[model samples]
Target: MKQVLSLWIGWRFYMARQSNRFISFISFASTAGIALGVAVLIIALSAMNGFERELEQRLLGVVPHGELTGVNEPIHQWQNIAQDASLIDGIVAAAPFVRISGLIQKPGGFQGLSVVGIQPDLEAKVSSIAQFMPKQSWQALAQGDKNNIVLGKGLADSLGLAIGDTLSLYTPSMGATKAQRIGAAKSHRFIVAGIFEIGGEMDLGTAYVPMDYAADILGLGDGVSGVRIKVDDVFAAPRLIRDLGYSQQQYMYLSDWTRTQGHLYQDIQLVRAVMYLVLALVIAVACFNIVSTLVMAVRDKQSEIAILLTMGMAKATVMGIFVVQGALNGILGCLIGGALGVLVALNLSSIASSIEQMLSVQLLSADVYFIDFLPSQLVLQDVALVISLALCMSLLSTIYPAWKASRVHPAMALAGR
Candidate 1:
């Protein structure tokens, strides 16, 4: 206990008085570097996390948590299938649907789009599309109005469509004489009943129509393409789908939102890892200064070390003193950096927006990116990992210097001084 106390006192004196101006300046620079590196890393990673969350929400808004579809035949008696599936413990809502690839043409232009045919009343119970529509109620589409259609905002923009604008759709239908592509290659008018925006790829490529109209166009007689299922917990979808007896061999396939958007999530994780490694190099450079500063301090304090050795101080105790001094610098730097990192991460969004406005350049573009706003989600685990890594590096920085200081012999240090 006395030895530890003495070592603490020695560290305090070295930091407070014996340290020269240049060493003091280097210490300040190292601390500032660690703080800046940590702060920037936290802010960047939090923003990436935010964007990832936004993508997930938007993706789930359009993609059903899971879908059970027939492979060999159009789903007959789908309402029964839906009813049976909904009775499963984790199932929230299940609705039959028909999906078709079609072309939408206006007088101004033409665009290709995926058309979803749904029972509008049940759609809101299963998906967020109803909630995201800007005009016309989901009930409007449910009324079985053959002429009505709902367009996604990006699809509307691409084809120059608006609410109440007349658009034409071209689709293939089975014929009595032969399997033939039917429906008007020319314009068959449809009224754009609503517009929706969810900031996802779906918004750029999809539209919704009533099931009856889709059946008429596609010649599907009371048959649906699939049943979309919403679950109480999205993460449990795969197991739930399997438990519900949906499989490839039954001429049925199941798809989940996670499968549909997993690529984006993986890409985000890869980019985050690469960015962190690049920024960590900054902290590594800062830690190099800790090594140099401690080495010079050891050289300058040789006379003091010799006197302590002559006074019967163990070599281990001498090593511990400088180790404690070096560790104090690291701990102080980490504390300051960790605190600053948290503050910056919490406010990164507003700060980034302000900077973008001041510069008159958009950093996040809605047209090119899934989301427009900067997002920050500071995870406790990420912060803890960063702090741990920085602390380890700081301790490692003291190793060689502390070892060299311990090697100083009483005779040589005394003779040299």
Candidate 2:
């Protein structure tokens, strides 16, 4: 019965009349601040989640999870190594590849690129390039024509190239003498059979040709540059490759996706972590308003508190009243903010597009960034964490003011009244 009375009194104080307008307004502001802070945090974290997802699915999708390379020369026994790798526990698929970095020249421009040679049929098992490339283009690549090559969309765009255009490739080869070294540069002509856009930096810097053609150009003589391996779990590629004992053998080395693009992923996580701490501070600042609100409430209700104490109400009950009143504000803010954040997160992509259209600006440029648009992916765990943290902060803010209210002396409070 005492608890019920305390709760009723708390509710009544929260909805107090206009004469306590200052306290009520402060409470409302506190609620609004918490709501805004929580909403922003959720939206920001969700955007980070979206970016991480796209990086894994789009960019890493085309890049091999791991590669087994020869230290001294090309892997001539790649077929047998690939077969052996397939039998490993974590490895899902393997494909042979020849990669050579050189300059590609066209009519008006030249660009440096890594030209990769892949067996058309075996390529599908290792990567999803076909899904991003035109069906007819991949078919052209499978024709075993050594004179044809595929260009990345960015590379093609920069060179103003289209299908059927011929480009010259220059590769520097080893020579015994200094004069021979300068003169030993080999140049090959290839027709552009296809152009592919993987929607990121890969499109601007990589190309593909038939393995036999690449072998002939490099004088590899049936040897492949390396074997690309796809594992059941992408992140575990390094550990799995190491366990296979290939790296310890002579003339062999291991490389995984982490070596090249891991830094970008680490950057994403760092930003996400920093933002979480910053937004948490924002929430703490907002919760400070709850302290101010309750402080003013305790001051204004001093006479009432004195009368209650004189009527034999316990000090703990007095504390509970103020705690409940302050907690109500936090609960309300959390509910409103959580709902709004989820709604915004769910439609973030469409909202970003609309904003871009209205402003006539590209927020994320395909040429400059990995992805061309804003993306958001709402995670329930993130949402729950934000709400819980906000509530805890708000609840803690009530402690000092509630304790102050509990210590109200009947004689002193009534004397002031």
Candidate 3:
């Protein structure tokens, strides 16, 4: 019966506090602050989740999970090595590649990039770039045209190249007798048979041709520079590469996506951690304002507190009254903020596109990042955790003010009133 009475009086006091204009204003401000902070935090977390998704699908999708590059020379038995690599437990597929450090002529200057030679059918099993490319563009390489090449749209556009356009690929090498002096530069002419766009810098710095052509030009004698490996689990690629390496008795240089693209993943994770810490502090600050609101209410209602004490109300009952009153503000804020956050998170990508179109500005550029637009994924876990955290902070903030209200002497409080 006492507990029920406390709850009734607590709710009444919460509703009655609006009579004090200043206290009312402070309470409103506190609730608004919590709402705003929670909404922004939710939006930020959703953006990070979206970026992580793109990292896996767009970037890692095209780049091989791992590779085994022959040391100082091409691997002559690449076919057998690829077959052996595919037999490993974690390894999914493997394909031979011939890499050339070459330059393409462009508008009175030259652009340097990696010109890789790949077999279309084998490449399909190991790399997803083929999936995004047109069948004609990807299969053109299999026709075995030493003079044919395929490159990214970004690279082709920068060099003013298109299908059927002839371009020159050149490599600088040293002369005989261990001389570092300038030597004969070998150059090959290639006709652009296809152009692919993967929406990344790889498009601007990489090209592909027939593996046989690359081997012939480099004098590798039917050998490939490396065998690119695809694995079922991306995170497991590093250790799996070592296992694949030990299976083959050759001394080769092992590499993984973690080596080439690990920094991007690290950066995303760092930003996410920072967002959580800073936003939690923001919510804490908002909750602390509840302390101030309750303090003023206790002072304003001193005579009422005195009357209740004289009527034999327990000190604990008085404490519970103020705690409930203060906590009411937190509940409203969490509910409103959480609802708004969910609505915005669901439409974030389209909203971003609309803003970009209206402002004529690009938020994300494919040249700089893996993706070119905002992405969001609403996770119930994040929502529940954020709301629970805010609610806990709100409850904690009420303790001091409620205790202070409970300690007021009935006679002293009545005399002051």
Candidate 4:
């Protein structure tokens, strides 16, 4: 019965429409502060989540998860090594590959490129190159057509290359004879088969050709530069590469995505941690408004508190009343903020696109940023955590005011009224 009475009093105090204007204003401010804090926190965290997803899907999707390479030369038995690696636990796919630094030239332009060689059919299992490439282009490569090659969109743009345009790929090396020193570079002709856009530095630096062509150019007689491995768990690639025993082999070496792309993931995590800390402070500051609101409420309701105590109200009940009242404010703020945050977070990408179109400005430039567009992904866990933190802070803020109200002497409070 006492619990029910305390709840009723708390509700009444919270719903009192005739309260002092200043007190009511402070209460409203408290609620609004909490709402703003929670909304901002949710939006920020959602953006971080979106960035991580983009990194995984767009960038990592094309890069090899792991690699097994020979120490001194090409892996001559790559086909057998690939077969062996694919049977290991956690490894989903393995494909032989060759990578070399080469220069690509058109009529009036030239650029350095990381030339990659892939078997189209086997490469499909290990990377998303096929998805970004046109159907006919990949099909041509799969059918053992050696005159074709694929270039990244940025690289193609730089060289003004298009499908069916012939380009020259050259690698500089020491000539075997003194007479050959004048032109100690080997050149190969290839038609541009396709252009792919992954929206990062890779698009500006990488090119692909058929594995057989690469073997001929690199002077590998039935050998590959390495075996690329794709695994079920991306984060475990480094450990999995070690488990494959490549590290123990005197003639082999192990490499994973961590070597090349781990810094991006680490930077994202660091930014996330800093944002969480800063936004949590925002919520904490907002909770201070609850303290202000409760303090004013206690002052205005002193006479009522005195009368209740005279009527045998327990001190604990007096404290419960304010706690309930302050908590209601926190709850209402969380609900409003959570709903708005979730709606915004889910559609942030579209919103950003609209803004960019209207303003005629690029928010995320591919050259400057890892991704080309803003992204967001609403996470229920983040929303719940924000609300829980706000509630805890709100409850704590009410304590001092509630205790002051409980300590009010009936004689003094009533006499002042």
Candidate 5:
């Protein structure tokens, strides 16, 4: 009955009009502050989560986990090397690749590209490039009947080339003399067989051709540039590549996607860590407002507290009333903020895309980043954690003020009144 009385009185006090307008205003400001802090924190964390997801799916999927390239000479025994590496545990599959640094000739002039030579069936075992393009486009490289090339969507857009378009390729000269090499780079022609879109910056620089054509153009017969490998764990790829390289006869350069794309992952984590710290401090500052609100309430209601104490109400019950009053503010703020945060997080990507379209702006540039546009992924766990933390902080803030209210002396308070 005493607990019920405390709860009833506390709720009445919370809902009742305060004589001091400033106290009511301060209490309202505290709720707003907590709500703002929580909503921003949830949105920021969700964006970071979305970026991590894209890193794994969009970028890492197309990039081989590990690679082993020849240092002094082209890999002549790539098939044997691939078979040996595949036999090892933790290794999923391996494919031979030929990398060519060249420029595609367009009407606008020459555009640079890092061309990859691949066998479609073998390439499928190591990377997911086939999934993003048509089956016919992916199979064109296997035909090996003509000089056909697959271009990235970004490259195609810039060069104004499409499928069936004949584009000229220029590579570094393999001439015997320096003057001959300086005079002109080697030039070749290819028909654009397909264009694959991954919506990444790599689209600007990456291209593909038949493995035979890649070696033939460079005048390296029956030799490949390197071996690409898929592994059980991407993080464990560097070590796996190194171990595989050690078993090879010639000097090899071992590398992984982490070397090329790890910066995106690290940047996401760094931003998330910094935002988490800043938002935590922001919530703490907002909680301080709750302290101030309760302190003023305790001072304002001292006379009422004294009357309650004198009326045979326990000091503990007096404390409970103030605690309940202050907790109501926190509960309301958390509920409002949590709901808003979840709603926004659920459709953040679409919302951002809409805003971008409306403003004629791009949040993430496709030419500079792996995936363009803002992304958001809300985890229920994150929302739960944020709400729980805010509530606990709010509950703690009520302690001192509640204790002060309980410590009110009936004689002293009545004397003041």
Candidate 6:
């Protein structure tokens, strides 16, 4: 206990002294190095996390969580299927749908589009489209009297159509002729009922029409392309899709939103990993500064170390003193950096916008990027890791230096002094 107390006092005195300007400068540099490393890591990780969250929201907002389709036979009994699907634990809504690939043409232009036929009332419960309409109404499109159609905003802009404009649609279908091509051409006219902007490719390429109209246009005889299912938990969709597939063997093809967007999500994950590794190199270089600072401290204090050794301090206790000192520096740096990182993350959007304005260039333009603001999500686990790693590096920096200090001889150190 006395030995420990003596060593603690010795360490406190060493740090408290204001006599060694060079030593103080080196110590300050070591602390700053750790802090900078931690701060950059936090910022990079938070940005990555925010980007991932943004993608998830946009993708889920526009795509169904799961879809069920006929494998070998038509899903003729959609009502029964929807009812059974609704009974499944996680399902929130199940709406039958028919999809057709066609072209929308205005007076002077045309664009390819995917047309979805839906029961408007049920679709409201299944998807976010009902909430994303910019003009007109989802229910209005379902009214048979109106021959209404809802076009994605980008599709409307591309074809030069607006609300109330008549747009012609052409879909391929089989003709009555015996030697006709696999499908004959079918044409229909629809009045634009609404425009929706979901801020994704769906906004640029999808259109919605009444189920009956789509069925007739696609030449589907009382058959739907699939049923879109909304689930309370998106993460559970893949498991549910697998179970649904097993339950209806040889009857359906089941898919989840993750499957539709899996590749994109995987790419994001890979990029995040590469980014972390690249930033960790910054921390590694900072740790090298820590090692150098401690080594220099050991050399400069050789005479003092020899005096302590001759007095009574054991080699292990000598090592502990330096280790504790290094750890203190690391702890101080981590606390400051963590607080700064969180503050920056919380205000990242405002900060980024200010920078953009100052530079006269938009950093996150909505036209070029999916989102218009810088995003940051500070994870607690990342913070903890940064602290732990910094402390570990600081402790490691003491090992060689402390060993060299313990080896100091009274005769040589006193002679040099």
Cα RMSDs, all models: 3.7, 2.6, 2.6, 2.8, 1.9, 4.1
lDDT of each: 0.76, 0.86, 0.87, 0.84, 0.87, 0.75
lDDT by residue (1-417, candidate 2, tens digit) is 878987898888887724677787888899998998899999999999999998888878888888888788888878787777867888988898988888777567666789998987898888888888898788877766457788888778888889999988887775436667546767888899998888767888889888888887778998998888888898888887776545344467788889988887998899999999998999899899999999999999999999999999999899989988999899999998999999999999999999999999988887777878888999999999999999999999999999999998999888884
State the lDDT of candidate 5 residue by residue for 1-417, as single tens digits: 989998999998888737678888988887887887788889988999999887887788898899999998899999889888977888999999999987766775677788899988899998899987888889899976569899888889888888999888787787547667635787788899999988878688888899888888877798999999999888888888888989988999989988988888889999999998898788778878888988898888888998999999998999899889888888888888888888899899999989999999988898778877787889888889888988898889899999999999999998994
Q: 55-112, model 3: which lDDT tens digit per residue?
A: 8887898888999999977799988887788678889999999999977778888788
Residue 26, candidate 5: Cα error in Å is: 1.6
Top candidate (lDDT): 3
Candidate 6 residues 264-298, lDDT tens each? 67877897788778766766666666667667777
Candidate 1 lDDT at 106 equals 55
lDDT of 4 at 241: 85
Candidate 5 lDDT score relative to the true structure: 0.87
TM-score of each prediction = 0.82, 0.91, 0.90, 0.91, 0.94, 0.81
Name the TM-score of candidate 2.
0.91
Error of 3 at 211 (Å): 2.6
For candidate 2, give the lDDT of residue 297. 90
Candidate 4 lDDT over 248-352, as tens digits, reads: 444777889999899999999999999989988888888888888888899889999999999999999999999888888888888888888888999999999
TM-score of 1: 0.82
Error of 2 at 121 (Å): 2.9
TM-score order of candidates, top first? 5, 4, 2, 3, 1, 6
Q: Between the candidate structures 1 and 3, which one is better when assessed by TM-score?
A: 3
- Top model by TM-score, which number? 5
